[model samples]
Target: MNCLKKTVLFTLLLLGISLSAQTVRKYSNEFMNIGVDAAAFGMANAVVASTSDVNAGYWNPAGLLKLEDNQISLMHAAYFANIASYDYAAFAMPLDKESVVAFSAIRFGVDDILNTTQLIDDQGNIDYNRISLFSTADYGFTFSYARALPLDGLNVGVNAKVIRRIIGDFASSWGFGLDAALQFETKSDWQFGVMARDITTTFNAWNINEEKFAEISGAVEGQNQELPETTEITLPKLQLGVAKKWVFHYDFSLLTEVDFNFRFAETNDVFSSSFASMTPAAGVEFGYIDLVFVRVGAGNFQNITQLDGSDSVGFQPNIGVGFKYKGIQVDYALTDIGDQSAALYSNVFSLKLDWSLFR
Candidate 1:
């Protein structure tokens, strides 16, 4: 927080904004919105209203205020036939009786891509030695803080993030954004949550190294292409969710949740679209005395009957199970990607550690 540091931060922020202006597009960074962790994804990301763990910082930061203990969580996912991987790590600590803070990081990467170039000889034969490998990756770091409001059962929170994207070694970009959220609960176990992501709109500045492109082109003939330098902008999105809990049979309980998502883009004017593009999601969880859990959910349903020729209305499904014991928890989930040609399934595994047990 010194003057020099502040100056550097401001410079970077301005650079990102200026570069991203050239190539800004609606929802340019959708990957950041993809839910992480098996439990959240398995519940169709409906936990926004009722989340109470470390992952809450990512889904609904206000939910972090519900935690009474320090905890850490890690998750790894295999996506799209193992060609890509996603990982998340988070740590949450209570600042006081009514306030909490958390730090989290996420990474998504695709590796082992073959870098092919044209052969120098005219025999039309490919040179195996000329082929190399490269990878693309996206990274994000989030710092969040939450506190209970003076109103009973009400909490508010905020998240600040730094983002970086890399493509092979030739291109890279930097970005930053802010998020705000609120959560409310009633005596009847009814909960509501609202979140605004990228409220100020995130900007990314792309820096392409033309010299690297030239070196690659020089090695291979007629295989070079010019690279475009530009920036990307992500518009603000709103998420609203509600949940209810039903308790019965001594230690058994059923939790149900529903969520609505809205995207605000220059192309999709909110006044005109009304609710046409709102995506609705629902999920259910069956829990036994906080020891074992089963979850199932589906969401992002669209008819597309009149808009497109396809009459298919299949919704993506997710299933997961979890076990908890002595402050240690493990979870696994399988999600359908809804793509016929690509990998049919994506898998996620997560582990959690609650330090309160040791205390």
Candidate 2:
């Protein structure tokens, strides 16, 4: 392959390795793993079988086959006490009565972080006026297509994605991956779906400027600091979901979904992890026809070994509400990460438009 392609692949690999470390800098493209719309967020990401809107571009492409009209959606979230933000946009167009295609993008970042030097001036005092600012950002672009199979109520889809990561102006990496999905529905409105992400073990190659690192970490006397050439790889992940809908009155409905995510990587110990490396989630939604929605969910149900060598489990909950008027829709959600204390919360909002309603 060409030089540019090689660099991107290497960067993708780095993303996976970082995630495995579970540190603040663990994942290079961690933003791509975040759910898009409030619906998915509030549902604890149990959306593989429940996605029917533009958010399907990220959740399960096969769900796009449910859209009869052209649609577009935009969403934004204030993450981690407003220290960072995540944004998403998607558009889906029907290719025929049974097929559809979509394009989407996401950006997550922390901007304008102050950069300072440790050097002290006279009297051992540092100069505050010399500080600079830099930003760290991650981006993902996806092109997805879905089509109904000849078998009744069956659909298949795929996503081709490109990813990029940047830390200030000194280090940046690019990578790519592929995702595949399958969805099926029963005559009683029960749905099942499966998705495989980064099916090819996406790879990322890093190109670092050692000079920038030396500036950040002070230089040693008569010693040269050089960056090392490294490549990162991310293994594929599998997620499965099941959803069911119950109709009460003619105008009211309730939807429930359950999801399980499986990772192939090894963990620290058997006590802190499950046999299959699994994470389970469940969500419920109440709707008034197609005009209003309320949702609640809980997930990230895993055990962790605390610093004191004690095993503990925490609760993470999410809630959301939505409104639809004509062709326009609005949604809002609040997600709580209990493991990170009470203050660690994420707020998400989204808007969607359907072109067919106007015509």
Candidate 3:
């Protein structure tokens, strides 16, 4: 049909725009990178290799294959001293012995932002009633599928993501992206995983409401003469991880993991270059009788240049605890402890439930 052809052409044009190097940005759609599940956050996002729950839909979908039953997860956290809210929910189920599927959603937003642009009226009179409230938000919805490979220890997965961004009535955009992941387990009990995010370069075509923007265009002279860029491109990123577990006394266990995150462009990460940058993270979890857990992690390593032209390394540290009983789990994490990094400390809590819990 003619309509279908036009749609296809439009998609191709968007892809072409995303492929252009000049249009790409390093942190476009960064809300998705904030991560979900307090347990994973507590681990400094180093669970890519050992994740095996509903939240795996966001970390590494291939781990979904380890799901033994239908599961649901929910999390809520506030950032910047409660000025912003971040929430997540997910559901996962096994399709058969060797296949699984999951769906997840995330929302990050600042609500009730005062819109003071209309405070001064055309008559040079200030009207208190002109002030209104609006919200700026970003949302991501993902569908994931995973299946076992012919190789004994190999599994593969994929994710289809839909991103939505809103800045009150002034602007809005929608984006689409894809992710691929692999997980492998060795006979020695070591687990390895690799995740390719935004594999095809996500593109968002912004729709700016010129009429609404005109209200504040002249707030600053010479700065509002032109409209903002309409296209945003998110380049690809990669993550590699490995993990292992050890048991002691037949009732206590320890799990440790390390991950390396790679970005295509130069950055101030621990390892940086003109072509790429890498940030390494490590985490450990100690479990007592498979019911109580304690976790610690460190990540987000970056080199900061001080005013004296001296550079220093900074990282974030996190700690967490969890308890599970009757197919229900509760987790809490304190992230960015001691404020060693630029980010503020946050307390995150999450809940997980198995379908059997309700039966």
Candidate 4:
């Protein structure tokens, strides 16, 4: 096929994947799993135990209780050769000495997609003017709450999520889910956390535009004959993390963390079984007087089958840096460095501001 034909085919494939909703899809609501915050991305998403900022609203809400002041955060990243954009924003504050609350929003979208179903007229004459443009997007809004427990150094949190997904003028879906998390700190400075996502089994109900479907039905021969399934379900997943920070010379510090992500159904994770799968991730950060920071992480371990039918281990590596001053912080992360994994790499940037910055 020609380059233009290839591009069109690829675009349609993406739309098809997004519109294929089922009752129990393994990767339903996957955009939410892409994560937020350059710092977390830098660490390959191993910050659940040590995340204590506004970004924690999406990572591990229990960590929100550690916020000492009201804060706001924003992040943006581009993927798939800039064909898609991912954006995030969040606000967090202490409701009281023992409790905290946060609000977060995320969007991942592909804009200006060409709609070519009408490119050819009834006379079989191709007309470029017949093409139109549309977009496909996914949005998630989370309301998170965290509270300190009566037990010293213990915290618990919960998140209520509203999900919306749109495929231009063709199909749309709305979903809701719940997440629960816990965090604990020890006198030895060890931090531990556990997060349960989609704990209540998230569900999405899709609404397809019959007219649009009919228009495309004839565009591709013997394809899309029937309407897609209207219901999509997302199963529960878990993440466990442990971290510790050590200070030296009263002006330097290092933080190390490890995380285990588990999905109930087996796939190609580092460790897989019929019942569950696990991927291990590790990250480290070195800081000088809490002002300059450097981070490195590795994760997304998978077993890939080579062309020769041999299984090979593959993983993603990430690196990032940050600077903080006067209640403001900026962070940058390069994920999937060196294209070591099957997925594309991305450059992520994020900003954080403490309310005190205005004072």
lDDT of each: 0.78, 0.77, 0.87, 0.91
**Candidate 2 Cα outliers beyond 4 Å, as residue runs:** 1-28, 118-125, 219-229, 268-276, 337-343, 357-359
Across residues 153-185, which tens digit of lDDT does each residue of candidate 4 receive?
A: 999999999999998788889999999999999
Point to the candidate with the largest TM-score. Answer: 4
* Range of the 10 consecutive residues with the lowest summed lDDT in candidate 2: 17-26
Give the per-residue Cα lDDT of candidate 1 at 290: 87
Best first by lDDT, ranked: 4, 3, 1, 2
The clash count for each model shown is: 1, 15, 0, 0
* Consecutive 10-residue window with the lowest summed lDDT within model 3: 13-22
Tens-digit per-residue lDDT, 1-359, candidate 3: 53333334333322323232235687788889988888988889899999989998899999999999999999999987777799999999999989999999999987766666677888989997987877778899999999999999899999999999887787788899999999999999899999999999988878877776565465434443456678888989999999999999999999999999999989899999999999999999999998999999999999998889999999999999999998999999999999589999899999999999878
Ranking the candidates on TM-score from highest down gives 4, 3, 2, 1
Give each model a TM-score: 0.84, 0.86, 0.93, 0.96
Two-way TM-score contest, 2 vs 4, winner: 4
The candidate maximizing lDDT is 4
lDDT string for model 2 (151-205, tens) is: 9999999999987777675567777889999999999899999999989866666
Query: What tens digits encode model 1's per-residue C-alpha lDDT throughout 123-206?
Result: 877777865666667899999999999999999999998989886766788999999999999998899999999998887887
Off-target runs (Cα >4 Å) in candidate 3 are 1-22
Model 1 segments more than 4 A misplaced: 1-22, 118-125, 213-226, 266-276, 303-308, 337-343, 357-359
Better of 1 and 4 by TM-score: 4
lDDT of 3: 0.87
